[model samples]
Target: MSDRPSPGPDVVVVGAGAVGATIAYTALVRGSARRVALHDIDAAKLEAEVLDISHGLSFTPRGSIVGSDDVEVCRGARVVVVTAGAKQKPGQTRMDLAGSTVALVRTLMPRLLEVAPDATYVMVTNPVDVVTTAALRLTGLPSRQLFGSGTVLDSSRLRHAISRRVGVAVQNVHAYVVGEHGDTEFPLWSSASLGGVPVRDWSRGHGGRLDEAELAEIADEVVHAAYRIIAGKGATNYAVALACCQIVESVLRDERRVLPVSTLLEGEYGVSGVCLSVPTVVGADGAVERLAVPMSDDEQHRLRLSAASIRATLEAVGD
Candidate 1:
């Protein structure tokens, strides 16, 4: 056996389920962190995940995995990912899991803060906005340091929809699904473009045009994709897990990347005290700034409604 104690992991993922395990796997595959510690309440599940991931570690880029149930395993982690709690099931929205998940977050958060107060907490559990808001309030961590894997996946779905309809590479499509990462989420169509040109202009150039009604339909599809995916697969994990990995990477590398992540609002979008997805500049210090991009009146109104819904939940739970 190696005599030396294993070095502290750069990232510690709480919850060793599909989402947490996939985040660890992706981090290792992408070489984002030198070490990843996975923790869960279930020792058997945690061990199984670790062994499975370990079997593949040798063939991938270098990284180490440690599995344990002790919350103290989170010590010295630069990025702490929270993927715990009741996962969404088919025919269920994230809100459906709110009460139970809130209880779960309340139970686990104090322990996490006690052990890894300095670590950036990335909320991946369902009703993520609510859980993330509760975490910020309970831990008294700076609001910016707690975030959710929010509309990033929704935005990706939107981009894919536009790409398929327009017959262009999704990379060339730049759109965002902002606001709540749930049924009420809205896409920022006014600012969407490609190569600094309007999407409509690009469509016209390609001998086509996506009418407002068609665009709304596409947005509806984006909003419902999670439900559709969950209905088919029984859970929405892989895409979200990948999104969490990306956010963790940004924090660990100090990559000042903009993502439609759920962050605390302090007067941005004319709202405060609620966590919602907005374009944010994220770095090692967590959400650095909220991007106050101009939006059409309709889009702005929808954003307000979404923010209001989140605020109501936060208040209802009295977090």
Candidate 2:
């Protein structure tokens, strides 16, 4: 490891796979953190990733990028993103990988905390809510300091699909995918908007209207886009890499931005104990508070079920 003088790595990524490498590149390119470290169990892969990242240093903002097979690189890290876990196979849901991921974290989290006990952890593995809940039990840190990269991507997918269908810029389209990051996830269509105008109002103004069926179709696409991508490319990485960058930036820069990350609920929306995706304000302090947006009764019911689903997986794989 190239020792940079004091104030060590601002970000350390565990797992040197496609997602991890992409996250390292994106974070440096975006200047999310000045010093970023990449660590993995495979020495050869970590060396290759380090060299690749080193080669591109001249093109990015002035920052140090290092990779290692040792978890020691994580020492003094401000944020450690855990993306090391088994990839989801074709025809599988994120929930299906729970056992393997749980096993992976059970081994890695303790080692990680040993070196970087103060770092905020960003859980990116599949079965994110379950892994996050398990990590919480293992680390016993403040709930705000660790969270899953939950349905944030699902919400992004929804916005993209809505933008495409409505011929609006993606940024102008506002939507959310709440509850689980898996099969039970649902779109908050009741309050979804286009530049602050409800979708219904926006569509009506444009001389068309989005009915329940159309919105549901878009939501369905958001929920299952991962399976399609994994089937096509063996793993889904690019969009998620960008999502992880956004998360790292939020903490590194202390941007108190609201995002839909998963944190253990203590009675939000009448749910508790389990960690599930919900709107949260994240900054240097990590997930600060979860926003309680209005949800229809059916939406609340489904959210509860989503929490229960993750809770069941957590119970099956004891902490």
Candidate 3:
């Protein structure tokens, strides 16, 4: 028999809960990774999830899925997506879970990093900005190699809202939600567009014109969409899992897709030392570059406010 060791998994999802399991399934089905490993503390849940997904392998692109309670399952992963944290209850803000989530990350991140030090880490636990900042401070990995799945989902929500209002395909609605992923997040309407037309200039055809007031309402809905989903269902998994898979695919495929992901800012837009979502280029190296997208002065101010909000949570968690 050959003595060569088998290569590690292409992706490692830490946490086998709703979000994590969905991410693992999405990655495999999308062909983002050929082998995905799931690591969680709960052995029964992990085992059940692995088996359930494994049963569906015949329908998906050729891939292998494995799970274990040990962090060793994460060893040699090229990309590690973290979704482990306290689940958010209805009426609770993402910041409300910060203390417990950040604490969990503090204890969990080092173990994952120890096994997959070279893996590009994507933090998805909410208050994601705070958790990401804590992870960066604790691990000291370069910012590009580690970032939060920030406003990527939020931006998708924003685009979807705009699409419905304008009666266009969501894929054609190009907009972004930047800043914190929580209550402080806001849309970059100044740069928003629908089918190459600036959003503000778009006139109604079948749908209503997106005027200033309607835009404001849309932004509010995007910010609270998660709460509405959480109130109805215990958690949001589908879209978020898809978003995480998009990041994983971009990294493994080196797609260099532009996404609004959270990374530590070093004087970008005059905000420094805080993790918040801004339009950034994500690829094999992780959040490789931050884009200086044009933003109205008001939008810039709001982004700073979002940064302050995340910084407060970081301090509260002793980061």
Maximum-lDDT candidate: 3
Write down the lDDT of every candidate, Cα atoms only: 0.84, 0.89, 0.92
- Could you arrange the candidates by lDDT from highest to lowest? 3, 2, 1
Global lDDT for candidate 2? 0.89
List runs of model 1 lying over 4 Å from the truth.
Answer: 1-6
Per candidate, the number of residue pairs that clash is 0, 0, 0
Looking at model 2, report the run of 10 residues with the lowest lDDT sum: 200-209
Worst ten-residue run, lDDT, model 1? 199-208
Give the TM-scores of the predictions, in the order they appear: 0.95, 0.96, 0.98
Best by TM-score: 3
Q: Model 2: residues >4 Å from true position, as ranges? A: 1-5
lDDT (Cα, 0-100) at 309 in candidate 1: 83
For model 1 the local lDDT of residue 285 reads 96
For 185-247, candidate 2 gives per-residue lDDT tens digits of 998888789878898676556645778788878878888898899888998889999988898
Clashes of 1: 0
User: Tens-digit lDDT track for model 1 on 266-306?
Assistant: 88767788788989888999887889887999888898899
Q: How far is candidate 3 from the true structure (C-alpha RMSD, Å)?
A: 0.9
